[model samples]
Target: MRASHAYFLFVGTLLTAAGYGATFLLTEHFRALGGSEIDTSTTLGGAMAGTLIGVPLVGWYAKKLKAARMGAMGAVSVAAGYGFLALLTTLTPLIALAGFLIGLGWGIFYLAGPMALSERVTDQDRGFWFTRFGAFQMAGIGFSPIVAAALVEHLGLSTRGAFGVIAGATLVAAVLLLTFEALSPQASQARAQTSNWMRALPALLSSRAIYPILMVGLGACVFSGMLTFQSSLVRGTGLEAGTFFAAYAVTVVVARFVLAPMINRADGDRASVVLLALMILGVVTAFGLVYGVPVQIASAILLGLGYGLVYTVIQTQAVNDAPPEHRSAALTWFVIAYFFGIFGFPVLGGWLIVTVGIAGFLAAVLAFAVAEMALALLRGRQTTRKPVSA
Candidate 1:
């Protein structure tokens, strides 16, 4: 890789870490300001919304702004969002505004940074590079709670103080991202052209692409549910809620570091079967957690492995199958499947939890996993009958 590209990767890693840390830290800080559960949920919802909506907008405007400029703006928003929170004593209403701004900033950074990475790396290196990107992200997120725990314990810091730390980290990340050279105007325009929504949608919805999207959407449902309710699920286990996050994070990091490459190399059919089967096992194990801690930890590890591999495989397929011109939109839609899962799964899980207690939630997750596996098998048959050039 070029030195400039390497710089982008380094900075990209930093920016990802900062963005995630801000999410974890700021949520805790927001609670300190008398923010409600509703506020927290909305904030996360807004961030997801921003990412879903912002990718398309960013795709449209890639020609107008350099990645560095976008990175700076994103960082500034993180700072301003957290800064606003610091000023508020109670933030129920204003929390939405904060969510919007923070989400927008986070969304911009999320989309632009990866696009830049994809631009810099060669085709042969794309999977490996993106895996590394995922690793840094996993590390950043995994490390955040530890950092937050330490800051709170050692520094006698308030929740707002932690936000300051998160904000500062993002600001530094933004600066690092800015040091990379800008893509030429022509190159930017070309990428934008490739991502044009008008031309891309129909092609993407073609019969060949539809099955992959379905498979991805199914996997995303499992993932989305976990992100939304894993904390709550851990809390439900009657273990110290505080410790659950630590265990979950550690398990995720282990899965990402150890299994991602192997999963990435698997054929789509083999990967699909394995991924969903693992997810089913994970949820079943998580259900067993209500009975013991060992089960809970096992569930966490299984879910982490299942999710980590499924995401990598689905994402790889999304990019590999799409025409070059539609690559960006393809990714955007691929992520949309993920966001839909994030948005929808929690609500369903919430209802299930109410109806069947903890077991209901696990049952629902297992059901989704099984159904996804079934769909994957059907698609596998189709893929066998009519192979596409990958």
Candidate 2:
């Protein structure tokens, strides 16, 4: 990889680690502050709410600003949020504000980083680069708990202190992003010519990009449901709570790194079908089969291979399908759809688990997986009949 690409990936990895590290520790931090369960949930909800608001806002501005600069601004917001989080002692609206800042920052970075990278690379190499970027992202998420543990256990820092450290790291990321923008070629900074997104919405939604957006949303539902409730699902299955996570993380990193070229070379539509099927099999193995460690691990591997590879494929498709001028908008909608499922489905999953037990939750997840598979098939057929515009 070029130095610029490598630097961009490193920055992405660092930002993700700082952002997700704080997120993983949020509950513990709130509880440490003597906050109630409701406070914790509400605070987290604030973050999700902020992300829902941020995605579109960033998308709108993406056309006007350099993606790297927007990402830097996002990092600043995240740092500010974390800095606020470090100083809080009581539950207040400030807590929500902090969460919102963090979420909004992440929302911007999520869209901006990919947008920037996509613009920098060619279509032929886009899938490989995206897969690598995603691998780094997963690595960040997977290793954050370890970093937090080191800080708290070895460094003798409190959870709040860790937030302070994370805040510093995020600021560093912001600086690096600015440096990246300075060193790279300047992209258009002119304002968008369109009056507004609402006027262009009909044409944008009518494109083949919708298929990947829908697939991503559905895929997020399955991914979140499985990960969020893995512990609950395995409560009595003689499995460790971290089993799925560890296995899944390792599998994703390996699959994305090792299989990216194959994915790049494969036919997009057929690959999506097969990959989505693997995800369904993973879900079935985890929830439907007799609960055991081997089965659980197998399920994790399947999910890792499936979702890990397919995400890059479909995301590339989402960009590839759009008109050049609308690529950012397409990606904007794609990220929004993903966050909606990531934040929205867990609430529904929690309700189902509470109302009708784990069976109900598993059934709902399966339905999503099936629906996603059906959509992949539909998209494949549609593409065959009418190839997506270049």
lDDT top scorer: 2
Please give, for residues 320-354, the per-residue lDDT of candidate 2 as tens digits: 88777777667677888888776567657656765
Q: How close is every model to the real structure, measured as TM-score?
A: 0.82, 0.83
- Collision count for each candidate, in order: 1, 0
In model 1, how large is the Cα lDDT of residue 32?
Answer: 64
Q: What lDDT does the true structure give each of the candidates? A: 0.63, 0.74
Q: Report the poorest 10 consecutive residues by lDDT, candidate 2.
A: 186-195
Off by over 4 Å in 1: 1-8, 21-36, 182-194, 236-258, 323-325, 343-364, 385-390
